[model samples]
Target chain A: MSTVSHNEITVTGLSIGYRHKKKEVVIASDLDFKVLKGQLTAIVGRNGIGKSTLLRTLARIQPALSGIIQIKGTPLTAYRNLAWAKITSLVLTEPIASKNLTVFELIALGRQPYTNWIGTLTASDTHKINEVIDRLTLNTIAHRKCFELSDGQLQRVLIARALAQDTQIILLDEPTSHLDLHHKVSILKLLKKIAQETQKTILFTSHEIELAIQLCDKMLLMGSDGFPFGTPRHLTDTGAFDKLFPHESVTFNSETQTFQVRD
Target chain B: MNEKKSYRLPFFLLTLVLVVGFLVNISWGSIHIPFEETLNALLGRPTETDSWQYIIWNYRIPKGLTAILVGAGLALSGLLMQTLFRNPLAGPFVLGISSGASLGTALLIMGASFFSGVLTQGLIGDISITVAASIGSFLVLFVVMTMASKVRDTMALLIIGLMFGSISAAIVSVLSYFSSAERLQRFVFWSFGSVGDLSWPQLTLLLTMILLGSILSILSIKVLNTLLLGEQYAQSMGIDMKKSRFILIVATGLLAGSITAFAGPIAFVGLAVPHLTRQLFNTSDHRILVPAVLLCGAILMLFCDLLAQLPGSAKVLPINAVTSLFGAPVVIWLLVRKQKMVF
Candidate 1:
């Protein structure tokens, strides 16, 4: 249970939010958790619960309001941008302003931190990219423009891009928000498989709590009162899932381990 | 991989058109020189008539070269702006650098008249105007650069640019209203845009500045491609957003400001050529589009310059008039023909 050496990300007393014009608006504070390597972890919460803020803060895209975030025992801020890029990657929910890039080219761009000044792919870069494309079953559409892709295919491609980045950790924000139920499950399963196979820590934020509890090895449940991080069953047994939503509208059925309406 | 092959034929045809356009532009001027004589003059062979050599060397070649340089410069500038803003409508002139140049020109020509003799000398007048235009543009560039550091939103930057443009335009209007008839005419003529008036030294300066801008743009190819993925993604890829944006804006300002100073704000080449290149090349890769837009811009400018000369007649149309009249329809045609825009 103590996998401190295998921790990909560790936070101590972290507070994440935004500061505007000398005014600080804290979304979540006093957070502490560790994400283990070779596991799929999901951060789940209701609307406006600072899921994205935590991901962005962990990715080092936004400054953490306060506290310690250490990646492999190094302070998050201690790593330079380029070096951090090699250790962690992000797949965002925002629509890409893609021009004429093929799926292959888009994936190859994941090597930006490692590529030469002009971003020309080397033999190994191309080899890694090809491997990702094949693993994701994207060979048929590798030559297609990213904008030409279906939502399911594009999500796979985005994950493939993160894999191609060759990072020890990947952070995703709502990676399956726009997909159907089947796609949502498939994507989560794929993420689980990728984590086990590559031994990389993969964390994503999603609203699909039931699916997350089913597939994820670990879960970070953010509530209005507290943030709890533990294995899905551990959190469930600890009564963390029941307090996630308002008790008036919904209740967590510990037997089924799913949300049920209080009729 | 095979996508590259699709652009080969179009690239070949574009090169052919550029060669033909270059020759046609040199050959078809007032007091027509024979094609053979024009070719001979271009090859450094002395033609039978001295006027042919004088016209070809002093006038035709520089004008032709000017068209190529400004065309490429403006097109690349437009490409940079569009990529930086991620807006299809963005262009080199979007930041109001041209208006700033106009304000400078207006102040020099109009405000200098109040001094009577300070800027009226031949070479001094020309130098003052160039200096004034550069001053005006750099002033705006400085302001935009300062604002760029503070503003992260591209649309906000665009709006600030428009505001700078409007303020300069208003100042120009006031200057024009208070100026004498002859000074006002001079300012109006400059606004008409000219490719034929650049002397050898001026052309040299234009080519050099454009070369600098183009090199900066080339250095930014990787960053530009990353930017298409949006800012946060680009940053995650290790791109320094502030540095990339600074280089992009500075490159755009240099190319746009210099071209406007010399060519008097040639229209449509920068704005239209990039869109046209994107359609024809069918790729958003800056590596391909940079060179493709460069050639397309040059060819389109040569064609416009050729038309502006009115070919058989002596009277030349204003270059701006020809650019909008000719370039606007091509953009409209591209828009009307396509069901959805790629970018």
Candidate 2:
């Protein structure tokens, strides 16, 4: 909303895709969106939708076919690797083989962008990491190896790593995919609280549209045909939720903020 | 403050372990040298017996140091390769670097027989197989690096490395087929691995190469740690995966290639040491893992080298055979225990 600062991320006319054998397969094109600072933005779509691809593009993990993504009004390419790392961090759904890493060690890695050539963490860096671990409630298991943690705890550990990065914007892909309902709500609540408290922009994708609509400040709804972006209320009122599901049984109920199926 | 203390403890213990391991290595060998004698010799104390002093200085000291250095080098190389490829199984031997060194040594030993002048002029005597081995190691390393850059997936790169190793093995077999019995025996013996064969000069060169390569690997720890999350994550963190991969491969080659050149493709230590170190330290931060693996590798290799000497007998088993005896079971145990440890 209007709370978005001048330094917020702006994607203009973004055409995103990958090149294979000299052929461009565009996932989404002519996409224009502005992500407000300190807001939790949910990207919701059905299976095979370009939600993950769009998130990847926004995080600069994948190249946009032909478009401009600006951070603080500067083109994404203007910032060097360390500069970008300092500004943005990402959490993926893929599991990593961080066998030897403790939760604290893994979180400490978020300070890599600021660490010196020898990769030494300074006192202030350690303080920041401890603060994130405490923020994520990971202090009890901070000494536990990543491999030893449960899926829910590991997910929080990953978020702690991102928090330790001290970035303005964080992009996550299906962070709730593998979690149980309790963990899912906990992680979403954590993200929402982080967005509010830290003033950090968070863009995440999920198949749980109803949950996202309730928790997020704004939503980007992508479908097979096109994508529509707006606040959850605006999108729900404009019938954007109608196009999300294929069956006629389910309908989006704006007043109750819930999904219903006709008898 | 407590967290900082916890982190520092492992580093201090690792340093202590390395120091103790080095001393134990010096004391235990084929000859039953007492700890006092070894310590005296190490500290420049004169012994009453010239032969004891000579034995410690000329033979045991260099060989002992070589084992430590070679062990550290191979373990560090394995750690770097595994991190760079993001494959737990990836190592110099898995990637064909060892096979390449063997092939190069085969070429040198076989090619020398063809030129009588090469043997007569003492060219074969001075040339040393280590040089040929290093060349071969570098060649395969370059090929692997090139292929890794072109390929996007870690599994594909691992497969390509295996393929390169197979090709090198094929070439080595061809060379062995035509070589003279004497030359074949030499090549075969070298392939079995031995830390005892290195002279002082060769040991110095090996140390220098390994130290330089390790320094390079340490310098890139930040990039490597980022890479643990995955290449895409690493890229978003501002690391150019291509450049970092190139540096890592070259560094792996230097450490792996040099050790193979001097020690003759010692097996098990490279694959097992890093894994063991990772388990012992329970941390993937390369800053800790790197040195921890180095010390663990040295200790394991030195212990194996001692076993190879076969105390109180003239019979010396191939160092590789001794290492494999200990190494293979550790790897099997690791595989069996895989369910317990998550990587």
Candidate 3:
């Protein structure tokens, strides 16, 4: 256990934003955090806080403006595309237009890094995909096309795809955007269970802050005061969650570790 | 995966259809050749009529093969474009390869017409038309490909392709206005499109290009599958999007370009066969779609050529017209019946 448990991700002095018209726009800067293996972490913030940007930067979809991102003690910049793909994968919020692909075929695509040029999955690739499918309880829908799946079922299948990549890290952007409260809780709970069982360092940007605080082992909070990275209870105790949004709309109550609406 | 075996039945069905279509196509032209005679002539056995053997060997067989090659090549290219662009409406000639070919012949025939008789109808050779069309399509394809790299958005690239095609077509229109009526009619005839009268050397060249394009497509099956998740996901999966886009564009160019060069702008088959194949297979897996599309394209083209032959009638129809006249209704019916068009 001691040999396997370590910091899977370490961000130092990370600044995330985009440049417009030759002007640098920094959404959040000087942010530092570490994600341990086998933990579910969340980056929660209000709208337009660059939560997706931070997640995308970690996923290597975009380059960080000025900072260091380390995955498994190696610099993210140093890892090549193929090597990085084997180490991490993404579950984007954008719906894929290819809704005609069956669940099994879509999930099987996660084996791209491991498969040959023609993508003929080996027995091991098949085993991994099937294992992930089983783990996600998708056997019933494996033969169904993606268009047939409900929002929740599709979310689970998307998670299954990321899991099937067999990477050490998984990054998702808004894994529960369009689902109901029940579906969101179930999806987040499923993510937590997979992290606990597989030792994957799962991190996702989400608007479901309260749910995330309850399910996540760690959280990185983006607020008006500054960025804070810690456990939910610790951040709650430090009043970091209190400054996330305007008090006029909602208030964070530390005693119950919940957000209360204002009159 | 178990899905591997699932496609074999469909493949068998399509192959059966393709074989029947090919035989029916080669047998029932204006001149009647019976089944026994066609089969015997194909097998190189002694036939009752020597003329039947010559017609079967020299005319019908080559024409049938050309139809098959043209169909298979255009369909494969369409699938590539549709997947790459992520557009359901995309077709093989979306890059304006056919239009570029048309412009090339226009420039050759009419570009010299008003200027001088150095390259008049008397002097213009079939080889020259083929070469000119090849160069024209290549030029337009080059511009589209160059834009393909610089532009990040695929939809923008699609628009650029349309625009580039329009620009060249506009150039052709301007060229046509200045030409003599006789040369204009000849150029118009070239645009009508045909799958017959190709010399052996031309057929061999078209075969070579289609074969090369298909091999490239097979090699890209993995990339295509990865791309179904979207380009960002594909890149996250270690696929270099620029390189993948370049490869896809080149393969599409090879197929669409050569077909237009040899067969003229044989339309609709490239655009519609993929949708038809999707409805048939009900999956986007290229492993199945690639082979399935090849067979389906060949079947549809052979049948379209048969219809164009107008069986037992002296008059023939332009293949370009027949493809749409015959294909659009089938595609429309399928899409409307299923109430879903697989993108």
Candidate 4:
């Protein structure tokens, strides 16, 4: 792994939402957070709580209404598509149609920004892709078409593609949503190992709050009213979990670090 | 993996079949020339007589070449449209550009009766129809591109194209109602499409335009592959989405419009050839798919033209009828098998 350098993504006073015609529907405002280098962060929320919106805004997939997103002290908007692609890689939640693409061909798409006009991969590009595939344990099925693989395996193939990009930051929206429990844990564990070993920053959203609390270095909890960001211990100590759920039905169990229903 | 290789062997066989088909087409005609005489004439060797030379040079050679070019062009245009719209049912006719050309031809034929002096004389009298058809195609191509800028959905664009075709069809019907019987017969014959109508000059023009457009598409294989994942994914891969879309649309328009202008709305070759090539090659890589589709299209067109000759009959069937007879059954089989059509 290369030595980690000034790896930081900062968002300040960021307001995100959609603007159609002249009207604007803001999802969240005054959101400020700094993701540190070489750490795994999980953004957790219930359905429709703006978790995906926030991730999209940060990744520059959608336009943010107000405020700035800076990577290494440079504004995100200043970078064109090619430069931006080199800096950040994204894994979307939708399933892609893999007609005749093998796992290797799909993963090679990550090198698009670096490829020339004819789309041929350089020696270094192939080496980096091979390294990523080997690291992800995708060597056995590397020749198989993506359509023949299971959902869990497909998810890994996508992540492998992101890794092949060799970017400083990787953002995935619900990377574990389609996996079984064992595959979920294994994927999360693999991500954690990647973050530490490669010294790359990784941010992903998930609804598995318990697993996130146990595995992530930092957590961002988004709720109906607003959002708060901190380490899991800091959030628990500040009673941030108390407001996440309704007061009537469920409560946060501080001892077991899980949610439970009131008797 | 070996099965994939074996599946591709038929494509080679198809090429052989097309060559034999072309030779057979050159043999049969009103002249009744033998196969050896035609071959010797084609090879530039001394023939027994000069009549066979004139028949082979003036008639059979240009006709055969036009069939191959038109077939390849229409098939390639259809493949591009299918990929662009992500719909298996989409084809060159769906865009209405062909209908627009038909309307232009109708206007020329109908206008000639009222003002004979203005219509009858030109730089090239017989060539006016081809020029008018090209102008018609260009006009419709411009309108569709303008509309595509506003509409983002693939289905919506297709519907708009169909609507454009219908409007052109309505205009052509009005013109047909007023045309003289002789002019109407000429226009109707053009609409059925045939390789025999092409003069040497028209064949040269068609060859240059179609080959240029096809090469442009071949160079765009990388962008097409990325687009298969969808526009958003393609954008994230550093492709300028708007620019890529514009270039692709222009190329498709040039290919489809020129073929329709030269040959009359030859259907099904564009709609069915890509699918057939996919089944034969078993690969989705555009680098492979594009060339395979081009060859397959040439073979299909040559075979259809051969069939159009009707062996020993005085009457010849229209080329469009022959192609549809071959193309429609394959499409029905594909739909019945429920093969997933990935754009």
Candidate 5:
């Protein structure tokens, strides 16, 4: 396969898990994968399978147990904290505590890595924020406080915030976990659109494997044995998704790209 | 843009109230200075009588200034605490600075008599209770700051502060139990909180500390605003949480420790003013909230001090009592009316 310069998040001999006391409890080891740029990738696995640990490690919020991970062509650790923040943004599952901030203000916060000392927005910053708001269709309620937003609107605002960060890569942990089917589909579609339009890598972890398979250009299936990274169709064709759960009760239907309980 | 403009009216009204409150506090101390004379005295002009000038310049001016400084410092400290902990109830004393001050004063007034002979014979002459109280508050602040560096969960910090408060309270209780009635009375009076007794030099020190703390807070406006989103999000945005939190705790410690040293644990101003600012401004942008809350705090403190003097009367209420009596009701009303707590 020809190696593309874009989406080259290469992990070699990666070991990720919890570092308790002085010992490291390895959750996944010897992992090798590359997250392609300009693609929406989803990390799907069962609960307690260390999906979050992997995401956190990859985002550089936590340290990897051992190995090398490179962003573009450079080592991930080579980037300074501020420079890393400019290159990538992560949206965690934690809810914002303050409701007093309006949508515009909250989204404008994405410009932190670029703003002045007081976090004041420049004209260019404002232009970028407005563009993201326009892209996300958040203009109607841009002035409304976050407390007044629906979950879907708030999620969109958060995504718009990442966009406003203007990073080359965006990572999210369960961006659509709380949404209904319609919202989930729409959000994933929006991510896909953003990836293609901006040529930025978008990755998220999700339990909605069905929707992910339908929309994600790439899927990172984290399993007990190993991680299998590829397009949904390629993984399905390779029977990788079938081996994901290893249980008789729940079965992966490759034809439909979904899981169904055995009758 | 229109929403930004709307903030001006309340800000204007708060400044007006602050001016009126300052005049009222100066105009009607135990010995009433007529408003005109108070104004003239403030303007550095000769009053109708030299005593009026002496009274205003020596006593009321410093006292009123003390009230403003204490109010602004405590309120600003509380705002930082609440934002830092992401808890609505967190205040300047939430870190046990006031309790530490109480312990210091208690030790001196109650425990001093035990070692009075030796201490008085050597190094402890004319030890101002204010100095002792500040020492105690700073001791506790140092400990809390040390722990703040180690802990990541803000809840742990809150609990640590409460634990410190309990430990100091236990020590104060023991000290009070062993003390004579006169010493106990002095300690009790100190604990009642005072803003009127500071000399110009002490007031100057308090003002300097408060000014430094407020400047630190202003410098941290970005961190403070981002903190409202919670720590994880703030971290993801490239905030150095440990450094920013340390700076915040240090700033709060300075403000709280300084005010507690001078005013004797003046309560509720720190806990209450930020809430009032948020309600009035209806926004949480720290840029607006910081200055607005500081001004509102000054206005409220001056008003409370004026009320404590009991207009046209010789008797004065303990500043602590007045703050709680006025502040608690407003907080309760806000909680009941809003029902949806933002923290």
Candidate 6:
């Protein structure tokens, strides 16, 4: 095997899906990609295209149907649960169980893996949490309850939680789904800044393909015919974006670098 | 953190109030002993009336201790259940623990009469009933947990827990139908729930269970906090779901089961105390909430016991009834005023 420099996550010939008892439902297959360090990657596709499933598979929230997910050159299954947690942090779109928790306390939970037996936050833990809060610019709302936060603010707080975990890789599932266009771009920009500044691998599943194309360093475009993984320009030049949605409904305008609604 | 300071004052006040509540519980009972005399008896000094000594040392003290154990155990288990199931409504009663104990006690005190009607009412020892109830609660919890492991869904487990309660309740009803009228009366007394008749040995056993359950709850604080993320995110953060669930179920069983075994399923305390504590404490971190439940539970139960005693009258209200009569309204008031039940 060649030494892939700065490769944080590498998936080869990967098949992702669900298994019910004996039957295997393969959602996507033959996915091969390299998620580089210090880069923001996006998984873009139509609904039910297994973009979230691919992210979950890479995060090991669920098992892949077949193929290898190598995290920093080691098989994902080879690491224990704790070891995997120390390397990759996950942010789901699902709401937290309790909204009574304050912003600071909730983010402090991301330090669970490193905390003491009783989950007490030591000096270092507090320092790390403060650094994350400051980095994410959540100072004003740090004392507010989660219920007090708006969707955009909550999304930032959730991202702050993942960052506080101090993992090398972060995976998010449709992070910008419910937010408006302004928030979606703000979150993407924040993610890009975080990935570049901290040298962490960040991948998120998003429906905002136009924003993703403008922001992401790499994109994994999911399709039934074939999954293409590359830089946005490379993928665009190869005419992949035009094949994303149905041409009758919408088409990609390569000239303006955006998707246009058809008449 | 400065926030830790704000909570510390409330915690200190709650502990102080608990101490005051305990002494008040001892001071005001069917027989009136002055607070100073009660303090003397508590301090192992001589009291003015010898009957006061006998009553305080022999009855009130043990009764108070039993109330504390029962209250703390139930409330801690309730908090554990709420956190484990991630449902604000979950508690020992909802999970069938109390009913399981009822079934065990029914099987022993009444089910035997169904077989031959040979054994007299006083023939069975108090210890035997306690043992039977403990076994019953643990067995049912074991079954619920086994299914939880298989299903891997918290909501389904909650439904299964309710179903177990219903099934045990049905069985208890059948046993009641077959037993003699005297046996039926005895079972009814047990169901009314008492904190008074526990002997020293029964108190010791209940104490052991409370100790172990509290220890387990302390150990589970980290896991419980993680669980607040919902199980999936918790699992993603390196929490072993099966192992954590098993420990929590065991802790809940020990606390809920043993209290039911000794005290006969005193209602309302387990479910109400956690909400009350959360309302006051203003945070869900189990590190604070666990010990907070211990004090809040004991304080609330002791206060309720004071009301049950009725101070001047020798007649006592059933603890189970008194708990609901007083506790339900307070919880309702809190929820109505706050516009939310603190989870």
TM-score, B chain alone, candidates in order:
0.95, 0.90, 0.96, 0.90, 0.95, 0.95
DockQ of each: 0.60, 0.52, 0.67, 0.34, 0.57, 0.66
TM-score, each model?
0.96, 0.90, 0.94, 0.88, 0.96, 0.95
DockQ of candidate 4 (2 decimals): 0.34
Q: Write the per-residue lDDT of candidate 5 for residues B24-47, one digit (tens) a residue.
A: 888888887788988998898988
Per-residue lDDT of model 2, residues A143-180, tens digit only: 87777789999999999988989999999999999899
Chain B of candidate 4 versus the native chain B: what TM-score?
Answer: 0.90
Q: Per-residue lDDT tens digits of candidate 3, residues B165-250?
A: 88888998999898889889889888888898887778899999999999999999989988899998998899988898999999
> Tens digits of per-residue lDDT for model 4 on B159-252?
9889989898888877778877877788888888877867788888889989888988887778877766666667677787777777777878
Better of 2 and 3 by DockQ: 3
| Per-residue lDDT over B25-137 for candidate 1, one digit per residue giving the tens place of the 0 to 100 score | 99999788999999999898989899999999999999999999888899999999998888888899888899889988898888776677766635336667778888888
What local lDDT does model 5 show for residue B93? 95
Clash tally, candidates in order: 0, 4, 0, 0, 2, 0
The collision pairs in model 6 are: none
Residues B144-183 of candidate 6 have per-residue lDDT tens digits of: 8788789867788889889988899999999998888887
Provide the lDDT at B204 for model 6: 87
Question: Which ranges of candidate 1 are over 4 A from the true structure?
Answer: B1-9, B112-124
RMSD of candidates 1 onward, in order: 2.0, 3.3, 2.4, 3.8, 2.0, 2.1
Judging by DockQ against the true structure, name the best candidate: 3
Model 5's interface RMSD: 2.3
lDDT of 1 by residue, A131-192 (tens): 99989999999998887888999999989999999999999999989999999999999999
Error of 5 at A61 (Å): 1.8
Model 2, runs deviating above 4 Å: A1-7, A247-263, B5-54, B110-126, B177-182, B328-339
Go through the candidates in order and give each one's C-alpha lDDT. 0.89, 0.81, 0.89, 0.81, 0.87, 0.88
